[model samples]
Target: MKPITMLALACLALSGCKNEEPAASVPSVELRGRLEVDQEKTSARQAQGIEGEYFRRVLTVDGSDMTLDAFINHYCPADTRDETCQKALRIKKIDDVSGATRFLPQGL
Candidate 1:
Protein backbone atom coordinates (compact mmCIF):
# COMPACT_ATOMS: atom_id res chain seq x y z
CA MET A 1 0.00 0.00 0.00
CA LYS A 2 1.24 3.55 -0.73
CA PRO A 3 2.34 5.80 2.21
CA ILE A 4 -0.19 8.49 1.10
CA THR A 5 -3.04 5.91 1.04
CA MET A 6 -2.13 4.67 4.56
CA LEU A 7 -2.09 8.27 5.87
CA ALA A 8 -5.50 8.96 4.30
CA LEU A 9 -7.02 5.82 5.84
CA ALA A 10 -5.62 6.75 9.28
CA CYS A 11 -7.07 10.28 9.02
CA LEU A 12 -10.46 8.92 8.01
CA ALA A 13 -10.53 6.49 10.99
CA LEU A 14 -9.65 9.29 13.45
CA SER A 15 -12.36 11.59 12.06
CA GLY A 16 -15.05 8.88 12.46
CA CYS A 17 -14.21 8.45 16.22
CA LYS A 18 -14.55 12.18 17.04
CA ASN A 19 -17.57 13.08 19.22
CA GLU A 20 -20.19 15.38 17.66
CA GLU A 21 -22.60 17.47 19.73
CA PRO A 22 -26.34 17.25 19.12
CA ALA A 23 -27.84 20.01 16.96
CA ALA A 24 -29.80 22.78 18.66
CA SER A 25 -33.58 22.36 18.35
CA VAL A 26 -35.41 25.01 16.35
CA PRO A 27 -38.38 26.88 17.86
CA SER A 28 -41.60 26.00 16.04
CA VAL A 29 -44.48 28.34 15.27
CA GLU A 30 -47.79 27.08 16.71
CA LEU A 31 -50.67 28.31 14.57
CA ARG A 32 -53.71 27.25 16.62
CA GLY A 33 -56.53 29.40 15.19
CA ARG A 34 -57.97 30.29 11.83
CA LEU A 35 -57.03 33.59 10.18
CA GLU A 36 -59.88 35.27 8.30
CA VAL A 37 -60.25 38.28 6.07
CA ASP A 38 -62.02 41.50 7.04
CA GLN A 39 -65.39 41.17 5.32
CA GLU A 40 -66.25 44.90 5.45
CA LYS A 41 -63.12 45.89 3.55
CA THR A 42 -63.48 43.06 1.03
CA SER A 43 -67.04 44.06 0.25
CA ALA A 44 -65.99 47.68 -0.20
CA ARG A 45 -63.44 46.69 -2.84
CA GLN A 46 -65.89 44.43 -4.63
CA ALA A 47 -68.33 47.31 -4.89
CA GLN A 48 -65.67 49.38 -6.69
CA GLY A 49 -65.30 46.75 -9.54
CA ILE A 50 -61.85 45.67 -8.42
CA GLU A 51 -60.80 42.53 -10.32
CA GLY A 52 -58.12 41.71 -7.80
CA GLU A 53 -59.58 41.99 -4.32
CA TYR A 54 -57.02 43.22 -1.82
CA PHE A 55 -58.00 42.83 1.83
CA ARG A 56 -56.47 42.93 5.26
CA ARG A 57 -56.46 40.29 7.96
CA VAL A 58 -55.05 40.29 11.47
CA LEU A 59 -52.80 37.42 12.53
CA THR A 60 -51.03 36.85 15.84
CA VAL A 61 -47.75 35.03 15.47
CA ASP A 62 -45.33 34.44 18.36
CA GLY A 63 -47.35 36.65 20.70
CA SER A 64 -47.28 39.52 18.20
CA ASP A 65 -50.39 40.69 16.32
CA MET A 66 -49.91 42.04 12.81
CA THR A 67 -52.21 43.03 9.97
CA LEU A 68 -51.55 41.51 6.57
CA ASP A 69 -53.04 42.28 3.18
CA ALA A 70 -54.09 39.32 1.01
CA PHE A 71 -55.27 39.44 -2.60
CA ILE A 72 -57.82 37.15 -4.23
CA ASN A 73 -58.77 36.78 -7.89
CA HIS A 74 -62.33 37.92 -8.50
CA TYR A 75 -63.97 37.32 -11.88
CA CYS A 76 -67.06 35.97 -13.52
CA PRO A 77 -67.25 32.19 -13.62
CA ALA A 78 -66.44 30.65 -17.00
CA ASP A 79 -69.80 28.88 -17.17
CA THR A 80 -71.73 32.09 -16.59
CA ARG A 81 -71.52 35.65 -17.94
CA ASP A 82 -73.84 37.30 -15.38
CA GLU A 83 -72.24 40.06 -13.30
CA THR A 84 -73.75 38.66 -10.08
CA CYS A 85 -72.08 35.33 -10.80
CA GLN A 86 -68.68 36.99 -10.42
CA LYS A 87 -66.99 35.92 -7.18
CA ALA A 88 -63.74 35.12 -5.54
CA LEU A 89 -63.36 31.36 -6.04
CA ARG A 90 -60.98 30.70 -3.23
CA ILE A 91 -61.48 28.18 -0.45
CA LYS A 92 -61.14 30.48 2.56
CA LYS A 93 -61.68 27.93 5.29
CA ILE A 94 -61.98 24.18 5.71
CA ASP A 95 -63.11 23.85 9.32
CA ASP A 96 -65.99 25.31 11.25
CA VAL A 97 -65.75 29.08 11.70
CA SER A 98 -68.10 29.39 14.67
CA GLY A 99 -67.22 28.77 18.37
CA ALA A 100 -63.49 29.17 17.74
CA THR A 101 -61.20 31.27 19.94
CA ARG A 102 -59.08 34.01 18.34
CA PHE A 103 -55.41 35.10 18.80
CA LEU A 104 -54.76 32.48 21.48
CA PRO A 105 -51.62 30.39 21.17
CA GLN A 106 -51.27 26.88 22.49
CA GLY A 107 -49.87 26.07 26.00
CA LEU A 108 -50.93 29.49 27.33
Candidate 2:
Protein backbone atom coordinates (compact mmCIF):
# COMPACT_ATOMS: atom_id res chain seq x y z
CA MET A 1 0.00 0.00 0.00
CA LYS A 2 1.06 3.65 -0.54
CA PRO A 3 2.83 5.41 2.40
CA ILE A 4 0.09 8.09 2.61
CA THR A 5 -2.67 5.44 2.68
CA MET A 6 -0.83 3.46 5.36
CA LEU A 7 -0.31 6.60 7.44
CA ALA A 8 -4.03 7.45 7.20
CA LEU A 9 -4.99 3.93 8.28
CA ALA A 10 -2.62 4.11 11.26
CA CYS A 11 -4.07 7.46 12.38
CA LEU A 12 -7.62 6.19 12.05
CA ALA A 13 -6.79 3.13 14.15
CA LEU A 14 -5.20 5.26 16.87
CA SER A 15 -8.20 7.60 17.02
CA GLY A 16 -10.63 4.69 17.35
CA CYS A 17 -8.78 3.34 20.40
CA LYS A 18 -8.32 6.78 22.05
CA ASN A 19 -11.62 6.97 23.90
CA GLU A 20 -14.65 4.74 23.84
CA GLU A 21 -15.92 5.80 27.24
CA PRO A 22 -19.54 6.86 27.38
CA ALA A 23 -20.20 10.52 28.05
CA ALA A 24 -21.02 11.37 31.66
CA SER A 25 -24.66 12.25 32.20
CA VAL A 26 -25.20 15.15 34.54
CA PRO A 27 -28.58 15.61 36.26
CA SER A 28 -30.24 18.79 35.12
CA VAL A 29 -32.75 20.83 37.17
CA GLU A 30 -35.43 23.21 35.95
CA LEU A 31 -34.88 26.96 36.25
CA ARG A 32 -37.85 29.35 36.08
CA GLY A 33 -37.76 33.14 36.25
CA ARG A 34 -40.81 35.25 37.06
CA LEU A 35 -41.38 38.05 34.58
CA GLU A 36 -41.31 41.58 35.89
CA VAL A 37 -41.82 44.48 33.47
CA ASP A 38 -40.38 47.82 34.54
CA GLN A 39 -43.18 49.99 35.82
CA GLU A 40 -41.61 53.23 34.57
CA LYS A 41 -41.25 51.95 31.03
CA THR A 42 -44.57 50.16 31.00
CA SER A 43 -46.55 53.23 29.99
CA ALA A 44 -44.09 54.33 27.33
CA ARG A 45 -43.70 50.87 25.92
CA GLN A 46 -47.46 50.41 25.93
CA ALA A 47 -47.94 53.74 24.16
CA GLN A 48 -45.38 52.73 21.54
CA GLY A 49 -47.11 49.34 21.33
CA ILE A 50 -43.92 47.53 22.24
CA GLU A 51 -42.38 45.72 25.16
CA GLY A 52 -40.11 47.40 27.70
CA GLU A 53 -37.33 46.16 29.91
CA TYR A 54 -38.57 43.20 31.88
CA PHE A 55 -37.11 40.62 34.23
CA ARG A 56 -37.98 37.15 35.48
CA ARG A 57 -37.91 35.33 38.82
CA VAL A 58 -37.39 31.69 39.57
CA LEU A 59 -40.69 30.18 40.66
CA THR A 60 -41.66 26.63 41.60
CA VAL A 61 -39.56 24.13 39.66
CA ASP A 62 -38.84 20.39 39.76
CA GLY A 63 -37.39 19.37 36.40
CA SER A 64 -34.78 20.23 33.79
CA ASP A 65 -36.67 20.47 30.52
CA MET A 66 -37.88 24.03 30.22
CA THR A 67 -35.65 27.03 29.43
CA LEU A 68 -36.20 30.78 29.86
CA ASP A 69 -36.52 31.41 26.14
CA ALA A 70 -38.85 28.52 25.54
CA PHE A 71 -41.11 29.44 28.44
CA ILE A 72 -41.47 33.03 27.23
CA ASN A 73 -42.32 32.01 23.69
CA HIS A 74 -44.75 29.33 24.75
CA TYR A 75 -46.55 31.41 27.37
CA CYS A 76 -46.00 34.97 26.22
CA PRO A 77 -46.36 35.88 22.59
CA ALA A 78 -44.75 39.14 21.49
CA ASP A 79 -47.62 40.02 19.16
CA THR A 80 -50.33 38.93 21.54
CA ARG A 81 -53.11 41.51 21.06
CA ASP A 82 -54.64 40.94 24.47
CA GLU A 83 -53.17 43.87 26.35
CA THR A 84 -55.47 43.33 29.29
CA CYS A 85 -54.44 39.71 29.62
CA GLN A 86 -50.77 40.52 29.27
CA LYS A 87 -50.93 43.11 32.00
CA ALA A 88 -52.61 40.68 34.32
CA LEU A 89 -49.87 38.07 33.99
CA ARG A 90 -47.34 38.22 36.77
CA ILE A 91 -45.36 35.04 37.43
CA LYS A 92 -44.58 31.74 35.70
CA LYS A 93 -43.55 28.49 37.24
CA ILE A 94 -41.54 25.75 35.59
CA ASP A 95 -43.45 22.49 36.05
CA ASP A 96 -42.63 18.83 35.68
CA VAL A 97 -45.27 17.87 33.09
CA SER A 98 -44.30 20.24 30.26
CA GLY A 99 -41.21 20.98 32.27
CA ALA A 100 -42.82 24.40 32.55
CA THR A 101 -45.23 26.00 34.98
CA ARG A 102 -46.76 29.31 33.88
CA PHE A 103 -48.19 31.27 36.81
CA LEU A 104 -50.35 34.15 35.68
CA PRO A 105 -52.15 36.61 37.94
CA GLN A 106 -54.76 33.98 38.65
CA GLY A 107 -52.63 30.92 39.37
CA LEU A 108 -50.27 28.38 37.90
**All candidates' TM-scores?**
0.23, 0.23
Clashes of each: 0, 9
**How accurate locally, in lDDT, is each candidate?**
0.40, 0.45
After superposing candidate 2, which stretches have Cα over 4 Å from the reference?
1-27, 38-44, 49-67, 70-101, 104-108
In angstroms, the error of model 2 at 71 is 11
Model 2 lDDT at residue 10: 93
lDDT of 1: 0.40
Clashing pairs in 1: none
Q: What shift in Å separates residue 47 of candidate 1 from its native position after superposition?
A: 62
